[model samples]
Target: MPLKMDAAALNAFLDQAFEQVADDFVVEDVATDRLTVRLEVSDKHLRPGGTVSGPTMFALADVGAYLMTLARIGPQALAVTTNCAIDFMHKPAARTDLLGEVRLLKLGKQLSVCDVLIYSKGQEPPVARASLTYAIPPQ
Candidate 1:
């Protein structure tokens, strides 16, 4: 399927609708079934060990999946996460940004399933991997 929105449009939507954390995430690319997002690392996103927290990584995956769904389905704010499972594989590199690559596996009428892989910037192996299921709101 074709994309209903692109990176710039998604970014604008995020700015208007989710202003609170909009600055933390940037949509780097949007394609037919995938989206790339960057999480700008900051002190608040770090834990005591100088690594990005689990919650922060989860947020990146969740938001990346949500935005990827919206890229395909258009602006449906009510669409919400139904289930999420994540595996923290490696420790994230300290004081560096994180990158998320989200791919839509299934886009059905009532649900969307997405896979998110997160990596520390300039790293090859993924720091975390997540599977997210979103419940698409009724029209």
Candidate 2:
């Protein structure tokens, strides 16, 4: 399906709909196969060991998946995550930004599934991987 929202549109939607964390994330690229989002790392995102917190990574995956779905289905702020499974593979680079690469695995009338790989900036291997299922609101 063709995209209903591009990176700019998605960013605008985030700003308007989720202003609380809008400044923390940036929609870097939007394409048919993938959407890339960057999380600006700050002290609040770090844990005691100077690594990115698991919750921060999960948030990136969730937001990335949500935006990926909205990119195809248009801005539906009510669409919510119904399920999420995440694996923390490696320690994230200290004080480095994280990038989430989202791939839509399935998009249907009621559900949208996405696979999200999180990586520290300049890293090759993924630091975490997440599978998320979103409940699409009825049209």
lDDT of 1 at 72: 91
Task: Name model 2 segments beyond 4 Å from true.
Answer: none
Which tens-of-lDDT digit does each residue in 1-139 have in candidate 2?
8999999999999999999999999999999769999999999999998999999999999999999999999999999999999999999999999999999999999999999999999997999999999999999
Clash tally, candidates in order: 0, 0
Which portions of model 1 show Cα errors greater than 4 Å? none
Query: Where's the lowest-lDDT run of ten residues in candidate 1?
Result: 1-10
TM-scores for all predictions: 0.98, 0.98
Weakest 10 consecutive residues of candidate 2 by summed lDDT:
24-33
TM-score of 1: 0.98
lDDT over C-alpha atoms for residue 67 of model 2: 98
Determine the C-alpha RMSD for candidate 2 after optimal superposition of all C-alphas.
0.6
User: lDDT of model 1 at residue 62?
Assistant: 96
Residue range 24-88, candidate 1, lDDT tens digits:
99999999988999999999999999999999999999999999999999998889999999999
Full-model lDDT for every candidate: 0.96, 0.97
TM-score of 2: 0.98
